[model samples]
Target chain A: MIDLELERFVYFADLFGIAIFSITGVLAARGKQIDLFGVMVLALATSLGGGTLRDLALNAHPLIWIADPLLLWAAIGAALLTFGYCRFWVLPRRALLVLDAAGLALFAIAGAEKAMALGFSPLIAVIMGISTGCAGGVIRDVLTGRIPGILQQDEFYATCALIGASFYVLLHGHLDANLLALSAMTLIFVIRLLAIYSGFRLPVFVVA
Target chain B: MIDLELERFVYFADLFGIAIFSITGVLAARGKQIDLFGVMVLALATSLGGGTLRDLALNAHPLIWIADPLLLWAAIGAALLTFGYCRFWVLPRRALLVLDAAGLALFAIAGAEKAMALGFSPLIAVIMGISTGCAGGVIRDVLTGRIPGILQQDEFYATCALIGASFYVLLHGHLDANLLALSAMTLIFVIRLLAIYSGFRLPVFVVA
Candidate 1:
């Protein structure tokens, strides 16, 4: 059974992740010249796309956004803030990347834990975690006509989520759930940060 | 309430649509040099993507593919067939387009009917119908590194689906379901075909 503290921590982390992802989504649309309604749609899709998929795939009714309207506001508010902020002030790119990494880690862990709570197997939990972390970005990239970063043979991205999710699911029963989630998120964040700084990439397979 | 004949007819039409979409997915992947497994993944995503999203959004339990394994085989088999055939024979591009149009019409109507059967609003049914008809191709286009044709506004595509779905929802109460579905499907097919041959396009909105 998950402790009350872990649930509370995850709820806050999820909201933060949604906001961060929404910001990234808005930023991705900078030159697209999309209308405000378009920006809001992109923000919502980026923040909620993965969890919505995860919930539906798991047959959990009452989508997370439907269950809690605050999450919708979180994404919308973040997008509006970014939409307003970028018009007048220069935003730091590196800081956004770091925040994005953190958001990815948090979303990944949250997704895996939800799957685990739903009694899915470790493999499914890991897959759902990675999907939760990465799907929003993919949706954004596709909407903006850019090749998805994760689908490319570059950076840690979903791989970081995969390993961290495995770490959580594997050690979930033996360790405190709260401690395990933090460690897993830290692991993903650190690995992603390293990939960002070092330009580490996966090798593409060559077929002859 | 849907009669047994209508349900049976829609089921067969759905299977046909699934196969046509899978073929299109496989065709889109040509020259990408993706492996067979990647091709299968794209085909499945293309064939099932829209329905999966529609089901999730509507909180419909046990996804179509999960409820009936034949649907899974339909997509996979179609992909494999296309993959093998394309290696030895030149595919008729026009033939494929006509079939794709038929598939689109069938899927849009089927999706609308399902939503209506679930007691959702007419507007929700139309939206769900369009999503179920178009989402899979969007996924395939993103995966294959192309701007999705539906998103491009160069053809009738989703607009045809939307109109057909609306037609069905508007008249479902008074007309014979089978006859109405056929009329709608024919309307979509003719419109899509006209768009294909006449180079019809929606005017792009310009922001100054």
Candidate 2:
């Protein structure tokens, strides 16, 4: 019973995250004069990439995209809609950053839960969360020649995910599933949003 | 005896492919004014993205990049060197395209061989081959906001890989390993180079 609900909740998270990420992806493609194909590919990369990495690392079968055709269709729909209206926006950039942060939070929690369910240890789950939260955007930025958000020292992006994952693991062990999940998501969302709004940042250091 | 020699050959091919891909990735970062960290990441993505996808699909352990530190080091070194000479080249664009093609060919055949060795069916091997050959470039292009060569109808990039993978599978049962690999690489290289040079292309059509 609880397992089934968790599955459905994760599905919702996946759908919402994909939609948000796809919108951001389309916005990122602005001014580039890329065709519809290019736009779609970017959207797909941002939306599906993190999950693909997570499932692969966990060695889970029938990759999420392969298992759920609806997700891909939804992503494509989101991309199409974003591509259609992207040019009309006065501040697509601001919308993109906010939505991207939301998607990152959703993905991070989803990744942590999935890794835990797969019997990975706490450390592994935290890594999975951060990786799933950030790797897609990193790949997106790298492909588009934009500076990957990860390598930058500007924002508290992946670090927020790390903290949230730890919080989730601790909370999940004590609470009901729904509350646990919601609390985890809230922790990530609030932390990331506050960091962005407050201009909190991580330090950059040169590795020798 | 033959098996050991084949492993050695593929190992060298992997290094060469990684180097070429990294060089191109570094070159792509040029004119983008990306920091050194961004450049190394882009180079790493281009060099290792294909193999990582292949390893994930096959449920292989440690990821190729994680298992082999040498490949990562080589990619970083190549990126730094390419970044240094990025401004000196008169035809950086042409160099990027040709080096990309070389990496494509090497990765395609190498990926096919890896799949075949894993006892995957020939069709799966061919699909894996093309996926492994082209995924990294697709990733690189998407990050840079450029059109991925495979998605474009302007040239027959992935088609070359498909053909070579099929040919390699046909030869797998008959020829010794070295000859089989050499033949496959040659076939893909010739086809891709001809397509690029002669402007041979596949037609673009929306899926109906």
Candidate 3:
């Protein structure tokens, strides 16, 4: 069935998303003087947290990473690579931003699809998508003793995910799979990239 | 109704649990040089994580602290107490160990009782109780960039909660309420204290 192909594609995207998040997590661990074990834990938490939370919230059985250990291995591999070659990697920060944008788009779409599979309402599905795409980074920051960037009302990080998730819900079954995926990814990537480059930010709701 | 009284007692136990956990969290953050906001967040996460997890797993609506801002204020009060007086109220680690034991016992009982009230099986209730009692500390450790003490094959932390949870479940509705509470609390406290004083620990399991 076409649905099977879609699922496979989404799973592949999920793996890439995991790798990106893991690499970012490893990078954050730099300058903090954490040992190798601490770095690995942060990497795992960053890569898997969003999906684990989504599964928990939806009461999905077996949790995604538990079911497919390949993602876990992939995250470990990515973290190891980052750790070993970070000094040689040119412009690590820029690379992280681009990969993070790709991950946000892919994860948001994947989360929305999963939510739809579970028969959640459109709004709830969208919310779940955003939560799934962003919660991992939030958990990573909190664990590393940083203010969760997502909660600080800065950065176009979660906003892009919300937009991509909405796009997925709108064009899920109406268009070709590649086109929809590309469009959603482009939407998130472009917005996030622009925000990073131009310093675009949303207004904070300061409590008086 | 008896159910009402039981609920009230569990609620108070949970509040006390939060206060105790917040104090520890605040103490943990003291030497780390985190800002005031970060300190409050660490305290809140340690105090509130277990209950939030319990509510989410049980599909309980309007999460406990979110429903009652009073609990939030109480945790803040506890955090402020730690920030203001931790240096002055220097107790021996053994004395603090006693406080930790009392907190662990009360939280395990409270968590199990709530799960039972939510109609989960006794097994599930006990698991929930242990998770609710210990997961906050796990979260705190992970966030502090350290391995969670419970995750390691170290002191009898979660095991004590697990034993107390099993005892409470076996005795549920059989004995009078006061006796049940006292026995469960005393069991966990005495066991944990003895373990600490006697240098008892579980063997490590390292997968080759």
Candidate 4:
């Protein structure tokens, strides 16, 4: 039997993550002049793309959106809200970064936990976690005709996900699942926030 | 029982599609200064992305590459060869177009057949087919930081795949599988080629 508190946490995490990612996707398309249909597509892609890929890789059927139509509605709602309010709100760049970081952390832990539940190996679980956290943004950037920031920028975004997922995998068996997940998510979020504040970046490989 | 001869034809078609798509992906990265690893990643994404999505959607486990290592090798070999010879061969633009069209037809039919075999609805099968044919190119363009040609260009590329896939689905049970598949593939290829040469294009959606 699943723990009720953990289930509730996961439920909220999933919804908030989807909403934040969808908003970010719509925000990214601000100057692209994409139509409303295009905005909805981008929002869906950003909010669900990673989980969809993880499910596909794991051969999990019916997909999350297929199983839970509420998630789809949430993404659509977020997109419409972003489209309507973006011009008037003029959200600060820092706010967007913080929201993205929170979504990344939530997604990373959820991905790793799902993979572990599916009996994947720890390494593969960690990889899935990172992919889950990053793939949506990659798809969003690609659709908008920009090189993915995760690929081009030296930011520690994906790296943070990797580190947090690894931590969760290492600690899950020894600790309460909820506590372990919360710790991992906090680690990812803190690291990301620190990286953004300190202008921290990884070194790029230069092809000679 | 699956027909052995038809299976053999599909096997060859799948291999050729992967190889051509891989090469096209590598070629598209030209002038982008992407590293060798990046090239291989792009090639794999281009050759396998569509099928991967289809398999995921259909809940088909053990993806084609995981089930058969040969497909992976083919993609790798194509990437390496393209990287080495692209500068020397300087393939004609028309030749590239023809090759792409052939791959599109092959992939489209293969996708539709796989979906049908897995008991998907006809409409979903056709959608998968078009996605299989066009997704590789979409990924390739996205990786190279360009708007997908299928999305931007007015060419009847995806439309050709759609028509051919619909034709295949309508006729598959009434005719020999191999003959029907070949007919569908030929129709797609010929229409794509004619569209290329005659400048046939669908009306673009102008955002007012």
Q: Against the true structure, candidate 2 has what lDDT?
A: 0.80
| Residue A92 lDDT (model 4) | 83
B1-208: candidate 4 lDDT, tens digit per residue: 2355776777677888999998887766665645554566677789988778777678788777656768878888987887777646666667678889999999999999888888898998899999989998987787777778888666689999999999999987899999898999999999999999999989888799
Cα deviation at B40, candidate 2, in Å, is: 18
| Index of the highest-DockQ prediction | 4
Please state the error at residue B79 of candidate 1 in Å. 12
Better of 2 and 3 by TM-score: 2
Better of 2 and 3 by lDDT: 2
What RMSD does each model have against the real structure? Answer: 6.8, 7.8, 8.8, 6.7
List, in order, the clash count of every candidate structure.
0, 9, 0, 0
Instruction: Give the TM-score, chain B only, in order for the candidates.
Output: 0.95, 0.93, 0.92, 0.94
In order, the Cα lDDT scores of the candidates are 0.83, 0.80, 0.79, 0.83
What does candidate 2's lDDT look like per residue over B1-208, in tens digits? Answer: 2456887788777888999999988877768888989888888998899999888877777887789999888888888888777657565467887888888888998898887887776766886788788888877877777767555556577778888989998889798889889888888888878987898765332221
Give candidate 3's whole-model lDDT: 0.79
DockQ of 1: 0.10
For residues B77-157, write the lDDT of model 1, one tens digit per residue: 998888778777878778768877988988998899889989999999999888888888888887878778887867669
The DockQ of each candidate is 0.10, 0.10, 0.06, 0.12
Output the worst ten-in-a-row residue range by lDDT, candidate 2 chain B.
B199-208
Candidate 1 structure quality by residue, lDDT tens digits, A1-208: 2456887777877898899999988888877889888998998899898888788788887888899999999999999999999889988878778988998999999999988887777866886788789888878887888766665555467778878999999998999878888899999999999999998765332222
